[model samples]
Structures are given as C-alpha cells and as structure tokens.
Target chain A: MNGVHDLGGSDGHGPINPEPNEPVFHAEWEKRVFGMFLPVAACGYFNLDEFRHAIERMGAPSYLNTSYYEHWLHAFETLLVEKGALSAAELAARQQQIAEEAR
Target chain B: MASSAHTRPLSEVEIRVKALESLLVEKGLIDLAAVDALIDKYEHKVGPRNGARVVARAWVDPAYKARLLSHGTEAIAELGYTGMQGEDMVVVENTPEVHNVLVCTLCSCYPWPTLGLPPVWYKSAPYRSRVVIDPRGVLQEFGLQLPESTEVRVWDSTSEVRYMVLPERPPGTEHLSEDELAALVTRDAMIGVTKVSA
Candidate 1:
C-alpha cells in the first residue's frame, strides 16, 4: 500500500527535532496503546502485516496528523472491527461511555 | 471530590483507548494484567541497554563481533535479546571510511528487543522522508559531520528484517572495562545518529 506512511524519499516535512532526554512514552495513554499490541496480538485476531496495513489504510491527513501511538490505537480499532473480534458500534458505545465518565 | 494534581482530562485518543481496552476485557478478548506485564517488560526489562551490552561485548571480543555481523539474530539471542521485532536482525558495522544509519521508510519497524521502542524523531515524517535521499545532510543535522570521503550507507528497515549499527569503538579507552564500554554506548549511537564517546 503506497501511502504517506511510506515516507522514504519524499521531502519537505521539516527538520528533525530530536527531543532532549525523551521518555519512552510521552503520555500514559500512549503507554496503554503500546501495551495493547502484544495481548491483542495474542488473541490471534490479526497478524503483524494486517496490523501495519490497517495503519496504512488511514487517510493521509489523519495518518500524518496523529501521534505515533495514535497510529497503533487506530490499527487496533480498525483490525478488531474488520476481524469480527469487536464491532464498530460496540466500540463507539464504549467510547461514548468513556467520554462521559471522563467528563 | 476535587481532581488531584496528577489528574487531568484524558485526551480524545486516550478516551478511545480506555474505551477499547475495557470493552476488549469485557469481551474476554484481551487481558489487562497481561498488558501491564508487557508494559513492564518494555519499560524496564528490555531497552537499548541490551543493545549497549551487545555493542560493548562486540567491541571487546573479536569473535563475538564476527558472530554478531554474520548471524545477528543468533548472536544477539546468545546475549538473551531475542523476540518480536528483533527476530531477524542485521548488525551493520560502522568504520572509519563508512558510516551506517537505519530508518524504516515504510513504517517504524525497529529492532525492539535490542533497542527497545524507537524515539519520537525516528518515527516522525521528516527523518523518514529525508534520510534516504540525503544521508549526509541528515547525518550533518544530527551533528555527525563525516569527511567528504566517508561513505554514508542508509539502511531502510523492512517488516521482516531490522538493522542496528555497530558503532566503531572510540579511541583512548584501552583500560575501559566491558561494563564501562556499555555505559558509554548511547541509544543514538546504536541508532547511528551519533558516535559513542569515551
């Protein structure tokens, strides 16, 4: 899948800004998203290729705008729904519940 | 109850993740405890320190160096850094005349078992897009100015195979122990963005 994620030779993004003393994860949410990979993987819902493909399938703007772990989160949601492990409606309902709880 | 100092509203993505996690747990599709253990493994048990040990060992032992370059996955596993993204590895050696750097042009396919998770800059669009076309320029931006004569080799990692740079040992550290050598090896050095100093 040729997408913005395949950013090999294309240019004009900007100067690389390597942060000083960067942590492994920037946010707790990012950590949760990172941790989700192995266990979700253990369920055998989708393989690594499918996982990467799901991320690649993101629209160019969304893919580029989102953070690194957001990409992982996107893949998890996309694959789970696509694989019948979870339905989109259920995920949406859960999201609503969580958003309400947070508020 | 008032929100504590540490408490804040979760980001939209965070809310989404929390929602997904809880639902997955409810459906018995994933284990929360297993997720915590995985986080612990990445946060503490595994990291670039593992790769530093490998680089330090190779610096001290020529035999190990040969093994690492030729049979990367096995040599690395001998040191007990094997699994996941590091299952198939290629350890590229940097030398006086040649410098090696790695990037996953397609995606962030790094040797996680060795170097742990990649830094943010590694996954950013700028580094990924520019490094392959203008290696010398990118290296220069990293403050690693090579001689005009030094060849810059840029390795683009794939899903199956990953690359790590075996940075050349710096001079004037003959008395340094292997542990000391490991301490000098930084994540960026292993990533080939910078050189390990004595």
Candidate 2:
C-alpha cells in the first residue's frame, strides 16, 4: 500500500522523498475530522438502514466541495448551538480569545 | 474528591457532553462499552475494503463492469454496501488502454461509504493544487511509472460527488476467485497511483 505522502509531487518522475521531520498536520487533520465524526457513527448514521439511502443520493460535486473537517465541524457546531449545548456568543467569545492569544 | 492537577482541561462543550454521557452511563441510558463497540464496528468494517471489493469485482466480471459504469452506487449496493457516503460515487475504469485517477481538487470529498475516510494527502492543499497540473508526476511520486503512451485522466471530486477507480485486472492470474481478486486491490490501485497485481 502506498503511504499518504507517496502521492503527488513535481517531476512526473522519481520516488517520494518527503522532508524529514516535516509536520504531518494535513494527515493529522484528516484523522481529527474522522474522530469528530465518531459521534455520527455512534448515532447510527452509518448503519445499513439509516444512511444507506442518503449515501446513494449524495452527489460527487458536493462531496468534493466540502472539506473533511468542515463537514463534521459544521454539523457539530450547528447541532450544539441548536441543542443549547453551546451559544453563539460563547463560541464567538472563545474564538476571539484564541485569536487574541495567538497574537 | 478534588480534581487532580494532572487532569485534562476540556472545553465547556466537551465538558457538557462528557457529563451528559456520564449521566447516561450511570442511569443505564447507554452503555459505554456499546459506544466503544459501535465506533470500532464502523471504523473497521466500513472503509476502503468496500472500494477494494467493488474494484476487484469489476476486474473479474464484465457484467459487473457494465453495471458499475452505468450505476456505480447501485452496483456497489448489490454487494450489500449502500448508503450516504457511497451515494454519489462514480467509478472510473482503468483499462490496459486507458488509466483513470481520482482527486478532490477543492477539499477531500471522498466516498465515505466505500472509502471510509480520505487520506490526509487527499485533503492537503499541496495535493489539490499540484495533482491536476502534474498528474503523471504525482503518480511517479507514488512509485507508479506508467508507460508514456498511457493517457491519464484526473477526476476532481466535489461536495456532491465522489470517485473511485476500477483498476484493470493485471495479467498472469486467470484462476483467482473474487475474494482473491479483492485482495489484490489496494487503496492506491483504486486511486490510480498503483495497479493491482497478483
């Protein structure tokens, strides 16, 4: 099996020579997105009876348009706010504080 | 008991959910073990193996190939693997005559039903930007050296659609059963970076 970094590069030729010690944030993000979807899995979204029909109707265009994390984050954020688990103001405040700390 | 200094600090939302789940566990509303089992079930059973099965079936059966080309999801569903992630999937066939590759140019719009999850590289900005312009180069980086005469086509997956490659059956293995054929089908083969071989 080809490793994740084993795909794509310049030259249309040569073996994958990834930079050593380079952060794998991109790959890590993919796993994190999958982790975020664990709740959906637990909620029976992946069961044969529930999501099968929906999966059959999903289009390629929409799937490609959204990022892995964006999908989970969108669902989680929306549901949390709707269920009163989180408020818009609290989320905004947390985001602002994180941004401020970064600066 | 006081909270330990080494305890992890969770976000407010995380804390709330954790508390809720703990309450459920205490009240027997849900079993923690069951949650762990459910997660394990999907993570292991519902991933790239599905795509591998489809690709392998296409390799051995001409009828299945026709069905896959015309209706990939329905054909895949015939294998008892149907649902949302596989819903918008398109199966691009690679023949000795033509090679097909898949990519999500914008983000990683993977066929979760079939592929379970998109690999990190598939979602990375570097891949999205570089794959379309230099597909051959990208394949080469994957240690796949195709003949210059072979044409390479890249399908960009989107929010509504996902793609999987139906790799051509390699020669020298005529007697292999369906399961054996599936074993030869790797994730990279489905991605067009590598060919399935016995």
True-vs-predicted CA distance for residue A22, candidate 2, Å: 16
Clash count per candidate: 0, 27
Give the lDDT of residue B32 in candidate 2. 60
Q: Which prediction has the highest DockQ against the true structure?
A: 1
Instruction: Score residue A84 of candidate 1 by CA lDDT.
Output: 94
**CAPRI grade of model 1:** medium
Q: Which portions of model 1 miss their true places by more than 4 Å?
A: B1-6
**Model 1 chain A: worst 10 consecutive residues (lDDT sum):** A94-103
* Residue-level error in angstroms, candidate 2, position B153: 0.5
Best candidate (score: TM-score): 1
The C-alpha local distance difference test score for the whole of candidate 2 amounts to 0.62
Off by over 4 Å in 2: A1-85, A88-103, B1-38
